[model samples]
Target: MRHAHTVEQVRAAEAELAGQPLMDRAVAGLAATCARLLRERRGRVYGSRVLVLAGSGDNGGDALFAGAALARRGAAVSAVLLSPEKAHRAALAALRATGGQVTTDQNVGLADFARADLILDGIVGIGGRSGLRPAAAPYATAPRTGLLVAVDLPSGVDADTGEVAGAALRADLTVTFGTHKPGLLIDPGAGHAGPVQLVPIGLRPPAAPVQALQHADLAALLPRPGAESDKYRRGVLGVRAGSERYPGAAQLVVAGALHGGAGAVRYLGRPGAEVVRRHPEVLLGDGRVQAWVVGPGSGEATVEALDATLAAEVPVLVDADGLTELARRGPGALAGRTAPTLLTPHTGEAARLLGGAATAERCAAARLRTARELADRYGATVLLKGSTTVVARPDGTARVNPTGTSWLATAGSGDVLAGLAGALLAAGLDPFDAASAAAYLHGLAGRLAAAGGNRLPFGSVHSTVGDRGEAPVTARQVAAALPAAWRNATAPQGGSQQDAAGLGD
Candidate 1:
């Protein structure tokens, strides 16, 4: 698991190491990474043109020290101080001692930014909540040939929420220290962050509010049948989805449930014949089930299905039209439920659930906040699906899904996800674990289907199909790839295939 600490948490942890050389450790790692990237881009670090965009904070100090280190190693390093008067005195003197050039001219900075082999973006620290200052805004749109590496985080992105308020420096790679920030894991801040590399400074903080699960984490959480396991013992998943108007939603949901790790799938809805025709093994009409999946193309029948599902003592997952009905009825309908309730909604549905001036655009911009608010208000586990799928628990803990492709933005993808999560719930995982595992597997399946096979290594960090030269895929194809994704997640880590960073393109 990759833990993402908030700015306040990072500060508290850093305070514990006040007497130590934290800045030195950070600079060493930054300089080493820059050297490695320089060597990879060109032939060597020596004689490479490096530019540092220095702000008034510790981030600027770190960049200047790193630039001085590069200058010592024969790299031509230049520092453009955005806040010349407030720059770190020690760091500035150190750079000057190393024969590094310093300038406060915006024109000189832009020129250096254009032609430098590498640009270190330390113009803003994690504390910065808004967009870039006017002096440094030009770098946001300036054309550059070399790689732009962010020191801790890209300037102009909210460290806690991943909301890019205005023009933010888009980095080719972000070298973060201590631990990951929530912004680097979620979009549109994630979109600006190309690739992230964590540089540990030995600051141990409290439990992280945000986390991303890796292959091993999922492998441990995934349920597997035992030797003497019967169909009932494994777990039964009850699905109430689709209507005559939108029968395809039922088909997709059932497909996802069947492939999911459930022992049996009992489907109840208007599209029973169609479902049976597609999947003969599906049991028509609902018997006793460990969990129930309601919604997903439910149309006019959503209210009835939701009431019936809610009446059951078993765990219930609400999505799609069911989510709309739940939003209309408010959280009162789920007030007396003894069983767990998992609410899955895309940005639009989430906005409706939130109500009161909440729009899809606002929900998308502040995904973490939106999911947390919904979870708290509804008193249930909320899975807000989007470019970065966030699973938020009512207790304030959350997990950001790091696996997925743009291809998952298909029509019935959410239905497939709802069914898969319901199956996990039936398999006896808690709401948080069920939702997190389902998102991970669903994302991997989408990647597999988009690639047309397991052409890319299982659990690859490339988040998009375009990252690996793949094609578009349908929701049906995504469901079909579930088994392969399951096997990959359960595969031994010692094997040739393994997952690296959970967050990526």
Candidate 2:
């Protein structure tokens, strides 16, 4: 798992570190990274033009010290001091001793900034909140001729929430010290941060409040059927999805379930015939099943199926149309459900469930808060899907999925996720693990499908809208790529990825 520490956690860890200066350690790492980037961009660091956008505190100190190191290495380094009077005195003196020039004039700074080979952004640190000050705001919209690198995080981004209250500098890369912040791994702030590289400073942080599941973590959580396991022993997933008007949803949902390691998939909806036609392997008319998934693309007829699924006393996953019905009926609809229940909703659906206070805009902006509130309000595991998929439990803890691309925002993707998650629940994983693991696989599948059945360089890959060309994916294609994605997750390091189809234990 990739753990993300909060600002408070990072500060607490810094307080516990023994004799070493945190700023010095951070500056050393920052300088090294800057040197490497300079080499890559300008062929050599000795004659490269470097500019530092320094502000008031430790962030500016880190930039100044790093500039001093670069200046000593023969780079033409200059510091644009946003607050010259309030700058770190020791760091400023060190930079001056190393032949680095500093100026407080914004016009002169921007002129030097335009011709520099690299720009080091140390305008704000994690503690500095509520976006950029007026003096620092211009850099957020400045022309990007040089390679921009953020010190710890991009200025104007909320380190704890990943929200950008105002204009923020968009870095080509960010070198963070000690640990990854919550903002670096999430969206909005993550978008500003670009790619991040962590530099260890020996600060042992406490248990992280936010974490993203990695391949090995998903491998451990995935259910494996034993040698003696039969169809019923493995598990059966009952899917109540699609109607006469939307038969394709049934096919997509079943496609996700078929490749999800479920022993059997039983269709229980208006489009049962359509589902069987598309997938001959699927069993029609559910008998005994381990878990039930309702209602993607469901019409008015789905209400009966929802009641029947809930009445069966098995784990139930509610999605799409089912969510709308649940919102209309309120929390009382789930009062009699003794078994585990999972609710999957997008931002708009979440707003409906949360009533008037939680609008689509509000939920989209505050994804973590919305997920937690929805989970607590409905007393179920809630998976709020978006750019960053968050799986929140009733107990207030949550897991954020980091594998997804914006390409997964295509139509019928949620239905696919709902089916996949239901299969995991049937396979005996608890609500939390089932939801999280399923989201992990679903996201991986989306990424794989988006990349055209090849491995993605996730560390360097930017947003789906940028870089990658027009690669449209159907829901069926995403399902078809699941086997490959599964193998990629479970395969040992340095070993070849085996065909995931027919390989489930």
lDDT of 2 by residue, 1-505 (tens): 6677889999889888756788878898999999999989888899889999999888899999999999999999999999888899999999999889999999888888788999999899989884899998988887759999999899998888777888888888888888888787666777788777788888899888777676677899988878999878878999988998888888888888888888899997787877888899899885989999988988876789788877878899999999999999898888877899999999999999999777988887778778889999899999999887888898877788766667778898888898889888999999899999988888778777877865754331224444364267878878887777787788785112221111110
Residues forming the 10-long window of minimal summed lDDT in candidate 1: 494-503
**Which residue pairs in model 2 clash with each other?**
225-505
Name every residue pair that clashes in candidate 1.
none
Task: Give me the runs in candidate 2 sitting further than 4 Å from their true place.
Answer: 454-463, 494-505
lDDT of 2 at 46: 100
Tell me the lDDT of candidate 1.
0.90
The TM-scores of all predictions, comma-separated, are 0.97, 0.93
